[model samples]
Target: MEIDFTNIKVIGFDADDTLWVNETYFREAEEEVGKLLSIYETPNKIDQELFKMEIKNLPTYGYGIKGFVLSMIELAIELSNGSVSNDIISKMLAIGKDMINKPIELLVGVEQVLSTLSKDYKLIVATKGDLLDQERKLENSGLLKYFHHIEVLSEKEEKNYSKLLQHLEIEPSEFLMIGNSLKSDVLPLVNMGSQAIHIPFHTTWQHEEVSHKDGHSSAFKTVKTITDVLNIIY
Candidate 1:
C-alpha cells in the first residue's frame, strides 16, 4: 500500500530497537541469569518464568532495566525457595550494571534517516522506559540534537498517543510514528488517525509481539530498514 505522508508535520520515533540495540542485551542477560540459576531450573524454563515475572511486575515497576533486574532477583529468590545467596544476587546486579553501562550501538542508517527527516519534519522520540536511562542514552547516542521533543512514556497505547498528540498541539492526521514494534509505535498512531512507518528490528521482545487478530489499519507502512523510510516519504 502507498501510504502518503504529505500531511505529516511531526514524526515520533521509538528509541531502543528502533534506532539502537536494546532487546539484544536483555536476551543476553536472560541467558546469563538462566545459567546463574541453572541448578534450580532449565534455561528455557528460567527464560519463560522471567518473562512472566516481568509482565506481572510491569504495572508496579513500569519499564526499564531496574524493573527487569528486580524481576530477575525475585525469580531467583523464588526458584531457590528463599535460599538464593548474596553472591548470586550480586552477580545479577552486575549483569544489570553491565547492560546499563554498555556502549550504545546505533542501527545502520539511523543517523542518515534522522538527519534527513529532521530538516523537513519535526522529529521527537516517543519511547517508553525509565526517564533517566532513556535520557542518558539520548545523551550518549549523540543523536539528541535531532529531536524537537523527547517523551519517555509509561505506556504507548492509543490513549497515550492521543495525549502526546494533544500535547503537541497537532491533530493526529499531522503526526506520524516510526518504530520497531507494531504494537507500540505503529498501531496506536494508526488507530488515532495518524500515519506510521514500521522498521522491524532483528529481534523483538515477546511482550511487543502482536497477532493478526488484533486488526491493524491501512494507515501504516512496514519497511525493511530505517533507510527505506526515505523512499516512502520522498
Candidate 2:
C-alpha cells in the first residue's frame, strides 16, 4: 500500500527485535525450558503451557526476563506437583541472568537507519519491557545518542500511543511508528490516523502476532529491513 510520510515529524521504533536480538533469546530459553522440564511433560506440551502462563501473568508481572523466569519456575512447580527441585530452579535463574548478561546483537542497518533518520526527524524508542533492562540495552547499544527520547511502555495499545503523542506534543498524523509486530507497532498507530512501517523480524512472540485479515490491511507499508526506511522517507 502507498503510505504518506510527508506529515510524519516523529518516528517511533520498537526495540527488542526491531533494534536488536530479543525474541531469539526467548526462543532459546523456551527450548531450554522444554529440556529442563521434559520429565514432567512433553516438550511441545511444556512449550504450550509456558505461553499460557506468560499470558496469564502479564497483568501481574508485565514483560521482561525476570517475568519470564518466574513463569518458568511456576510452571516447574505445577508440572512437578511442587516437587520441582532447587537445582532446576537455580538453573532457570541462571538462564534469566544469562539472557540479560548477553551482549547486544544489533540487526543489520540499525545504526545507519537511525543515524540517517535522526537528522531529519525526531527519533524515539517506543517499546515495552522492563525499564531497567531496556535502559541497559540502549546504553550498551551505542545508538542511544541518536534518539531524542526513549519510552518504555507497559503495553503498546492505542491509548498508550495516544499518550505518547500527547507527550511529544505532536498530532497523530505527525507520528510514524516502525516495528516488526503489526499488532503492537503498526495497527494501533494506523487506527489513530498515524503512519507506520512494518519490518518483519525473523522471530516474533506468538502473542505479538495478528490474524491474517487484520495483518493484510492496506493502511501501512511493510519493508524488508531498517535501511528501507531511508528510501521511504526520502
Candidate 3:
C-alpha cells in the first residue's frame, strides 16, 4: 500500500531494538538464568517458567532489566522451593548487572538515518521501559541530541499514543512512529489514525510478536531497514 507521509511533522523512534541492541542481551541473560536453575529442571522447562513469571509480574514491575532481574530471583526461589543458595542468587544479580553494562551497539544506519531525518522532521523517542534505564541507554547511545523529545511510556496502547500526541500538541495524522515491534509500535499507532513503519530486527521478544491478522491495516508500512525510511519520507 502506498501511504502518504506528506503531513508527518513528528517522527518517533523506538529506542531498544530500533536504535541499538537490547533484546539480544535479554535473551543471553535468560540463557544464563536457565543454566543457573538447571539443577531444578531442564533448560527448556526453566525457560518456560521464567517467561511465565515475567508475564505474571508485568503489572507489578512493568518492563526493563531491573524487573527482569527481580523475576529471575523470584523464579529461582520458586523453582528450588526456597532452597536456592545465596551464591546462586548473587550470580543471577551479576547476570543482570552484566546485561545493564553491556555496550550500546547501534543497529546499522541508525545514526545516519537519525541525522538525516532530524533535519526535516521533529524527531522524538517514543519507547517503553524503566525510565532511568531508558534514559541511561539514551545518554550512552550518543543519539539523544537528535531527539526533540523523549517519552518513556508505561505501555504502548492506543490510549498511550493518544496521550503522547495530545501532550505534544500534534494531531494523530501528523505523527509517525518507527520501530521493530508491530504489536507495540505499529498497530497501536495505526489504530489511532497515526502512521507507522516496521523495521524487523533479527530477534523479537515473544510478547512483542504479532500476527499478520493483527497488522493487516494499510495505515502503516514495513521496510527492511531503518534507512529505507528516507526513501519513503524524502
**How would the candidate models be sorted by lDDT, starting from the highest?**
2, 1, 3
TM-score of each: 0.97, 0.98, 0.97
Question: What ranges in model 2 sit over 4 Å off?
Answer: none
- Tens-place lDDT per residue, model 2, 1-234, is 457999889999999999899999999999999999999999999999999999999999999998999999999999999999999999999999999999999999999999889889999999999999999999999999999999999999999999999999999999999999999999999998999999999988999999999888788988999899898899
Can you write out model 1's per-residue Cα lDDT over 66-184, one digit (the tens) per residue? 99999999999999999999999999999999999999999999999999999999999999999999999999999999999999999999999888888999998899899999889
CA deviation > 4 Å runs, candidate 1: 213-217
Q: In terms of lDDT, which candidate is stronger, 1 or 2?
A: 2
Worst 10 residues of 2 by lDDT: 1-10
- Candidate that would win on lDDT: 2
lDDT (Cα, tens digit) per residue for candidate 3, span 41-69: 99999889899999999999999999999
**Against the hidden true structure, what lDDT does model 1 obtain?**
0.92
| Model 2 error, position 224 (Å) | 0.7
Checking candidate 1 for backbone clashes, the offending pairs are: none
Ranking by TM-score: 2, 3, 1
Q: What's model 2's lDDT at 161?
A: 93
Q: Pick the candidate with the highest TM-score.
A: 2
